[model samples]
Target chain A: MRNITLSKAVNEALAEEMRLDSTVILMGEDVAEAGTPFKVTSGLVEEFGTTRVIDTPISEPGFTGLAVGAAMTGLRPVVDIMFGDFLFLIMDQLCNQAAKTHYMSGGKLTVPMVVRTNMGATRRSAAQHSQSLHALVAHIPGIKVAMPSSAYEAKGLMKTAIRDNNPVIIFEDKLMYQDKAPVPEQEYLIPFGAAHILREGSDITLVATSSMVQVAQAAALHLAEQGVSAEVIDPRTIAPLDEETILTSVKKTSRAIVIDEGHQSYGVTAEIAARIAEKAFYHLDAPVQRLGAMDVPIPFSPALEDLTVPTPDDVVARALMAMRGELFHAL
Target chain B: MAKPAQKNSDAYLHMYRQMVKIRVFEDSANELYLTAKMPGLTHMYSGQEAVAVGICEALETRDKITSTHRGHGHCVAKGANFKQMFCELLGKDEGYCHGKGGSMHIADQANGNLGANAIVGGSAGIATGAALTAKTLGTGDVAVCFFGDGALGQGLLYECMNMAALWDLPVIYACENNLYGEYTHVSEMAAGALMDRASAFGIEGHEVDGQDVLAVNELSQQLVARARNGEGPFFMLLNTYRYHGHHVGDINRAYYRSKEEETFWKETRDPITNFGDWLVTEKLASFDELQALHAEIKTEAKAAVNYALSAAYPAVEDVTEHVFAETV
Candidate 1:
């Protein structure tokens, strides 16, 4: 095992995949020379050459559509969107073309492509750059959505997404790119829809995604000191959601709280909470609580921005409410 | 410009057959829609047959082409079966997309047809990307992007053309300037000349008489050869017109265009009639032979429509299929 940052894990995955398959190519703004603004693809051009590591003009719709067409033809293209918020610029390619090609062609064509983008708000990049829009893509069918929590999960999920035959979007938490964790030296792959159980407890289940996994884990530790045993579940992929694991965990705990960075209404947290309420209605001891970012746009002020998204304290408070059964009447 | 030696009779006959096939197929589709035999909307490829047939004649089976919403001509020109196309229009199970994509999304990937895009300039990037794939893989294949004049204002098309020229990718941007961008005149929507769009990117651009199938074919040969030889992308503006309305439901076009203007082109500039006249005048085939070919194609189109009408709709359970190549 080797300790590496999440960004390094992503770079390793791209390098290993390009080494394994000649068809794997990378394209994005400054992805080849400058390795993106985040520097995730910094040294890829040296190892893979410019042919495989392509730096495209700063046109999101143009390059995104080109990547879709490239995937349809022969190459397996991994397009870096630079920022997850820029997805709105390329929605026509992502949502309409890439996501619907396989189905629209009646299974005659497959778009084996990966769109690597970053999300989260801690860097104070303001509203446009700090939004987490995974739910917008998760709502669309045919496209798979993956969000990695740690360096290990990032490496595994990135490899799996690169090899998948359909269009897959992997949203890496920009705030967690520098976070280090132990990853296996050899190759590994984490399949889609498999939720990882970080910790097991009996009081309640904390269903988290992306960077919220760390937040939920910290909250679980805080709850443990107060005699509350909270189980933490990290759903790696949001589209092919691990409903089985979530349902089973909710049944075991009889209470659940969903934590996400996206907005609270009509978002990933709301979807998960609604599913738990519908599927595990009789198994619940209290209402399923959802803790997510506020409905307001992410502000530039540090204080306002920090308060917009849920913190470890917020998860702990929600878990405590679920455990005390006070959440039942509030819902 | 010097005229080349007389072409082979077989080549002219093939071009005539292709144009006739597109015309007959589109006429049958219009009839089907009017008679309520077919469901959904359709954009006819009438009057623009020579452009699709002529340009496609220059392409090899392995060379790719991306098409627009009015794509039946491109699909037929790219060698798609008329029976399957009818099945698609009728929303039958044997269709290309199993009744899912309908008219606007017919694709034959195996035949190097990269599907028809409903968006105006949507397929330009796809064609450019396919050229990039060919260049990277050393496939020696060229891609043609077939869009209408309406797409001239799209920024994505310019972006794609800029990249293709910068990288010297093997792509052909075939713009069929049919005088209008849907309801509005092309003059109102576009600024300066259409060919200037390509010249601004340092790519060579040309204009062709869209009604003259032989003219389009002759120019396409040079452009396709240039791309295949790694000479980079080329743009061609095919000056053409659509005899029918933009779509099947857009029959009353008097609000947008004058009847006299439409009749002037229909009588003098009809691609099939002009090509038929040329075939006779050049002694390539007698008028009787051309008539016999048209009759045969009409029968074939009728048979395809009958087959599609008899074909079943996709099963209700199969509606969920093809959502992914491999289900997760």
Candidate 2:
């Protein structure tokens, strides 16, 4: 295993996939010359030339739909959205067309397309730039949504997403891009709908997604000092959710806290919490608590933004409350 | 010496039959709706038969098409099974989409019938995307988008036009003007002419007399041939009119358009009658043969309605089925 940052792992995966498949082409606003907004695709254009590493005009809906069309015919396209917030501009193509083509066409066509986008509350990118709306896409039927919290999972999940037959949206956390992890040097792919147990404990099961995984891990570490062990579970994908892993963990611990960067209402956390209540409600010793952003436009101010999004402290406090059989209503 | 032209008589006869079939089917559908025999809204395609028939005649069997709400003509002209279409409208288990998609959303992708969208300008972007797929995959296929004059004002249409022009995609933007955009007049709603809009995007455009099936057929042949030869896209604005209300729900006598204008356009600009007159006056076809074709289509449409009515309704459990493909 080789230690690498999450951004480098994605770069390596793209380079390897492009090398293996001639039909694999990358397109986005600044993917070719600018080396991606986060530099996850640095040196890719230099390696693969302009034909493979395409820099499209700032036409999200046009290029995104084009990529879906291309994928439906033969080629596999990796499209990068500079920010997750901009997905609203092209939701028609992504949610309606890309997600429905295979089924609408009565299984006559398949879109083997991968959309790589960054989501987080860090960087103070303001209301339009710092929002995690993967839940909106997860509500759609056909599309698959994956959020990798580590460099190792990034490479594996990206490879799996690219090779998958359906359209997969890979939401990479902006803060986790710089975080390092031991990624295998050899070729590998992390299967979708699988949950990773970041830490094991008997006290409480802290379920998190995207960047919240890191926050949950930090909270678990801090709680370890207080002699309170917390099991952190990172569900890599939200659509094909690994309910078995979450239910099992919650059943064992009898307490749970779901940390998400999106709004609490009808969000991924709410869905997960509802699922837990439906299946493992009897096992829960306490009410299901979710630590997520307040229901509002993500604030631009650093202080207000910090207050809105769930931080490690927020996650820990919530987990501790759940462990103590305390119900804290903060919706 | 030039090679002898293949016997296109059979092909032309088939096209004529299909166009008549669409007109007959639509007329019957309107009658059914008026008699309260059919449930839900029905968008009639009575007077715009030639536009769909002319363009679809130029396409190969595998070439795709994206259609608008008034899409029964396009579906019939492109050789969609009449029974299946009737079944879809009836919301039956044996429907094309298994009762999930009704008249507005009827699709059969196996035969390259991409879909007919409910939104006025929704299919343009999708058609452009489908054409991009064809070009990218080297499929040697083209996609045709059929919309009304109302769609000409939509941003998605312009976006698609710009993208298709920039990439030189294999797409045909077939706009059936029909003189009216819902209740509003096209002249009042549209900012500029459609040909000017296409020119602004650096795409070729043509304005055709939609009543003349031969003119549209000949022009579309050239455009489809160009697309097949890998030379960009074509936009054709068919100047025509609908013989019925915009939708079945709005069949009031007095609203926006005058009775005189509707009568003048319908009586003078009827595409089927014009085509039939040209066939007979020019001695290209006989009156008896045309009557026989019309008769055959009426019988076929009746059979389709019977088939649809006799078909079973889908089980309640099947409502949740096919939300997504099971495999991927």
Candidate 3:
């Protein structure tokens, strides 16, 4: 196993897949030469050439819709949406067209496409660029959504997503791009809908997604010093969520806190928290807690933005609240 | 090559029959709605039959097409049968999409039809993407994107057109300028010249009489060949008129258009009637044969409608089935 940066992992995944199959093509604005603003796709155009590594114009809907059509045909197009916020521009093409084409065509058509994007805050990019908008896509029925927390998860999940038959959108936390994690040199794949257990404990269950997985792990680490055992579960794929794993973990702990970067209300945290509240209601603990980004446009001010997203301290405090049987949450 | 040199009488008769088939399909679909038989409204392709038949006749079975909401003409022209189309319209089991995709979303992939999108100008990207697929896979196939005058208002058309031109993709952007975009006139919606939109991207542009099947067919053959030969990504505007309103339920359309204009198109510029007259004049088909052909199609349409009306819907247990494909 080699400790590689998440950006390198993603680039490796794309390179490996492109080397394996000629039909796998990459297209996005600046993806070919500039390697995207995030630089996750650097060296791809060199390896695969322009025919496979395409640089599309900055038309989100245009390129996304094109990816959908290409997927329906023979090509496996991996579209790079530079930011997650731009997903709104291609809603009609992505949600209405890509998501429904297979079902609408009564199983006759398949859109084997992948949209690799980034989701997170703290880059001081402000509202439009920093928002974690995976919930908007996960709400749709047909498309699959995956959020990778580390380099290993990023590479494996990406390879799996590229091979999936349906339309799959993957959100990689932009903040974690340079972060190093152990990734194997030999090819590996992380299947969708499987939750990865980062830490094992019985005191409380911390169900987190994407970047929140690291936050939960930090909180777990701090809590372990305080003689409290916290289990960190990262739901790799949110759409086909591993309910069995989450529910089983929550059942053992009796207390749960779902953390995510999206807004708290009607968001990923709310959905997971509500599920724990509904299914494990009889497990006798404090109410299912949720720690998500504040319900406001992500602020550009460093001081103000620091208060919006849930940090490790937030998870520690929330876990303490559940531990103390405190039925109330604080702002 | 003496008597008008148009001796392909079989092809002429087939084109005539296809036009009649579209007319009959819409006429029967309108009756189905009026009699409260069909569940939802339908957009009629009555006056613009020639554009679809003209462009599609030039394409081989390997060629792909993306259609619009007003798509029955394209569907039939691309060789979709009446029974399955009626089944799709009536929401029955035997429909092209197994009744999931009704009139607005019918996709006959077997006939190289990508789909008919409900969103205005939605299929532009999909069509261009298909061209990209053909290029990348070296499939030697061309894709035709069919959108109405209304779609000119959408940015996606220009975006895809720009990409198609840049990539030199084998695609034909066929704009059926029926003069209206859902109760509004084309002049109110589109700015500047339509052909200039193509020239802005350096893509070749052409215009044809949409009601003249021969004219539309002649241009379509040349464009399709050029596209296949890598001299492609052409845009053609077929000037036509809509015989019906925005939809079948849009009966009171005097607010936007006139009865005289409608009558003028139906009487003098009807694609099927004019084509039939030309066929008889050129000795391609006799007058009686054209009449018999129309009657035969009408009878076939009647039978298909009856079959679709009696066909069962998908089973209740199958409601949640196929939300996603099981495999690639």
Candidate 4:
């Protein structure tokens, strides 16, 4: 295993896939010459040439729709949306066209494409630039949603998403791009719907996604010092959710705290919490607690932005509440 | 005034048969919808028969075309089976989309039809992308984007046009300028000349009489040849009108257009009548032969309706199937 940053891992995955398959092409605004603002595709153009690594004009719906058509016809296009917040601009293409083509065509067509974008707040990019909207796409039926927690997960999940026969949206946390993890030098793949248990414990279960996995792990470590054994589970993909892993973990602990960076109301946290409440109700010692971003839009100010999303401390506090049987009363 | 050349007689006959087939099929569909035999909405392609036939005639079986809401004409012109298309409109198990997509989303990939997009300007990018695929794969295939005048106002069209021109992709942007964007006239929505929009993107653009099938077919041949030869994208604005309303429910269109205007186009410049008249005048086919062909198409359309009506509905347990590719 070799240590690499999450951004490098994503770049490596694109490079590897492009090398393996000549049909694979990359397109986005500033993805070629500039490698995107985040530099996720910095050296792709040099390696694959401009034809394969394209820099499109700033039209989200246009290029996104173009990618959908390309996928349907012949090419496997990996579209890099500069920001996840811009998904709203291409919802018609992504949700309506790309997501519906396979079913709409009666199993006659398949869009083997990947739309890679970054999600999360706290970069001071403000409301439009900083937002975790994975839940919006996870709600879509035809498309698959992947959220990788570490460099290893990022590389493995991206490779898997590219090979998959349907449209897959990979939401990378911009804040975690610089974070490093041990990724294997050889090829590997992490299948969708399989949740990874980051830390093992029996007292309580903490379910997190994307950057929230780090927060959950930090909280678990803090809980361990205080004689609380907390289990941290990261569901790499939200759409094909690892229900069995989550339910089994919840059954063992009998208490669960769902963590996500998206809005608390009608978001990923609520969806997972509702599932646990319905399927694992009798196994639970207390109601599933959810800690997500505040209902308001992510503010521009550092202090306000920090307050909006769930912090490690917030996860620890929620875990403590669940352990002490005080979460219901505290609410 | 002049006879069609003996060499091109067969091609003209084929084009005429396809156009008549589309008209008869659409007329049958209207009857089914009015009589409550078919469920859901339909955007019929009644008057714009020549546009679909003209452009599709220039394409080979391997070439791809993306269509719009009023798309049955395109499907038929691209060689789709009338029986299967009828089955899809009726929402039967034997339909192209297994009865799930209904009218707005009918697609037949085998015939090189990408899809019929319900959203305005939705297929522009898809068609352009198919061109990109063709160019990348070294395939001689060309992609045709069939949109209406309404789609001209959509930003996605401009975006794709600019890219197709920039990349020199093998695509033909065939705009069926039916003179209206649903309820609003194209004059109110589009700014400057429609062809000028293509020139701004550095692509060659042309305007043709949509009612003249031969004129459209002549231009489509040039454009398709240019695209196949790696000469870049070509944009053509086919000036046409829809004899029917925007949809079947839009039977009464006095609110947006005039009866005189509709009558003038239908009476003087109806695409099918003009082409049929040309066929008779040119001695390519006698008047009796043309009438016989129409009868034959009508019978075929009627048989399709019967087939669709008798076809089974998809099973209840299979409702959620095909949501994703089975392999995925």
Q: Candidate 3's residue-wise lDDT over A19-92, tens digit each?
A: 99899999999998899988999999998999999999989999999999999889999999999999999999
Over the stretch A113-154, how does candidate 1's per-residue lDDT look in tens digits?
A: 999998998789999999999999999999999999999999
> What TM-score, computed on C-alpha atoms, does each candidate reach?
0.98, 0.94, 0.98, 0.98
Between which residue pairs do clashes occur in model 3? none
lDDT of prediction 1: 0.92
lDDT of 2 by residue, B1-328 (tens): 1121242556656767877888888877877787787779989888888899988988888898888889899988887888888888888877777776788878877677777777678777668867876776688898898999988777778877887887788999998998788888898989866689889988999998887777788888889989988887888989888888888777874777888988887788777777677667756689999998898889988999988988998888875565545444
Whole-model lDDT per candidate: 0.92, 0.83, 0.92, 0.92
TM-score of 3: 0.98
> lDDT by residue for model 1 over B1-328, one digit each (tens)?
1242367889888989999999999999999999999898899999999999999999999999999999999999999989999999998999988888888999988788989998889988889989999999999999999999999989889889988988899999999999988898999999998888989999999998999998899989988998999997999999999888889999899989999999999999999998898779878799999999999999999999999999999999988998878835
Error of 2 at B12 (Å): 3.0
Off by over 4 Å in 3: A329-331, B1-7
Model 3 residue A288 lDDT score = 88
Docking class of 3: high
Report fnat in order of the candidates: 0.67, 0.24, 0.79, 0.84
Q: What is the TM-score of candidate 2?
A: 0.94
lDDT of 2 at B67: 84
TM-score of candidate 4 versus the correct structure, residues matched by position: 0.98
Q: What tens digits encode model 4's per-residue C-alpha lDDT throughout A206-226?
A: 999999999999999999999
lDDT of 3 at A157: 97
Model 1 chain A: worst 10 consecutive residues (lDDT sum): A322-331
lDDT of 2 by residue, A1-331 (tens): 6799999999999999999987888988889879987898989999998767877778887778767766765678999999999899878888877887665544556778999997888588898888888988999998999998889989999998888888999999887888999988889988999999989999899999988888899999999988888999999998789999999999999989999988988898899999999999999898988778899888888878888878888877777777676656553
Better of 2 and 3 by TM-score: 3
Instruction: For candidate 4, give the lDDT of residue A46.
Output: 98
Distance from true location, Cα of A244 in model 3, Å: 0.7
